[model samples]
Target: PAEVPAGPYDALLEAAASALDANDFDGAVQAYKNVLSDDPGNPEAKLGLAQAELLGRVQGMDPQAVRKEAADNPGEVNAQLAAADLDLVGGHVEDAFGRLVEAVRRTAGDDRDAARLRLLELFEVIGPEDPRVTAARTSLARVLF
Candidate 1:
């Protein structure tokens, strides 16, 4: 059998996957971006990049602190966002979605927009096909308009 040559992005793809597995979100994001620079619209790289970016934002955050801040100040958009991120990372997907949705409902103008944008990012992190995203999207739309 003849040996096949490796694709240019193969190593980078592997590196990105490894980085993601190790929770090295910055490395994964960079590697995924490198792969994307070569092969635009690559699904794996796109998804990996989204995941990495989401994880990177919450990298050094303390979940308990975030939750407490949100609890202490429900109207604070940043605190709510951090709490939602913690919920998502902790596998409380519905809780994360609900938090953002409530934020969207309670806030106005730029604060509402910020919460909505964060919710969309969480949708990406959860993948478009997720039922939670679908439900949240509907709820978000209701709140927006």
Candidate 2:
């Protein structure tokens, strides 16, 4: 199929990016959702909304505490997930992926699935083309199998 040119929603994408840049997570999420409502499969809007929502989840967290909790509870899925989110938002992309991959390795059933799903979501936030995400995907595949 021929690639469709950018249309009217480019403005909404720009607005979402601007809101994300300014730390207005709610605004960013809303703008991205507006674009998604019009273009349901819009990749940029999906990525932006995922990032905005992830940041919103961890916005009020104390990083030091989160990290300590994760470090102290390697088998705790929630702790590890929270720390991984914090790591990604803090620009420690590799660390975030590694942590979640390990979480998947150590967990089973629902816990394992949660870790795996969150890792995939982070992949979207980072974009699949990233080398780090590629490496993480390989690592996740290995651990899962």
Candidate 3:
């Protein structure tokens, strides 16, 4: 177990870590829950929980979960981007749309450009013939470059 928290915390963290590595989402979710129950202020616990709920990848891994790690402290854009990837891979077209929509709404620069590029990639994944792709493209055109 975790000697730091000195109890269920270590075990909880361990369980969540193992589950996350194996992509056993439900197990990670439950383990993270236990970590939070013992130490809501623990950064690892918070990050682990968010990671468990996060649906997609970012920066070669999971951004939704990473975003949870910093909690607006930093790298939130990466997290958003990760979420967009997740949505695309998971076949959650609307979700991918939403993630990019929010990203495009940012300060209107690199982040927006990155999001637009990612949205375009998703369109390719789903195929340009998809209606959602049309709508996503139209939305991107309206809100982004």
Can you give the lDDT of residue 24 in candidate 1? 91
C-alpha lDDT (0 to 100) for residue 37 of candidate 2: 93
Lowest lDDT block of 10, candidate 1: 41-50
lDDT of 1: 0.90
Q: Encode model 3's per-residue lDDT on 103-134: one tens digit a residue.
A: 77763678677777767656655666788888
- Winner by TM-score between candidate 3 and candidate 2: 2
Error of 3 at 114 (Å): 0.9
lDDT of 1 by residue, 21-115 (tens): 99898899999999899899787788888788888988889888888999999999999998998898889999999999999999999999999
Candidate 1 vs. true structure, TM-score: 0.85
> Which is better, 1 or 2, measured by TM-score?
2
RMSD of each: 2.5, 3.6, 14.9
lDDT of each: 0.90, 0.95, 0.68
Candidate 1: deviation at residue 7, Å? 5.6
Q: In what order do the candidates fall by TM-score, top score first?
A: 2, 1, 3
After the best TM-score superposition of candidate 1, give how far the Cα of residue 13 lies from its true spot, in angstroms. Answer: 1.8
Q: Kindly list the per-residue Cα lDDT of model 2 for residues 1-145, writing each as its tens digit.
A: 9998878898889989999999999999999999999898999899999999898989989999999999999999999999999999889999999999999999999999999999999998999899999999999999988
Q: How accurate locally is residue 41 in candidate 3, as Cα lDDT from 0 to 100? A: 75
Descending-lDDT candidate ranking: 2, 1, 3
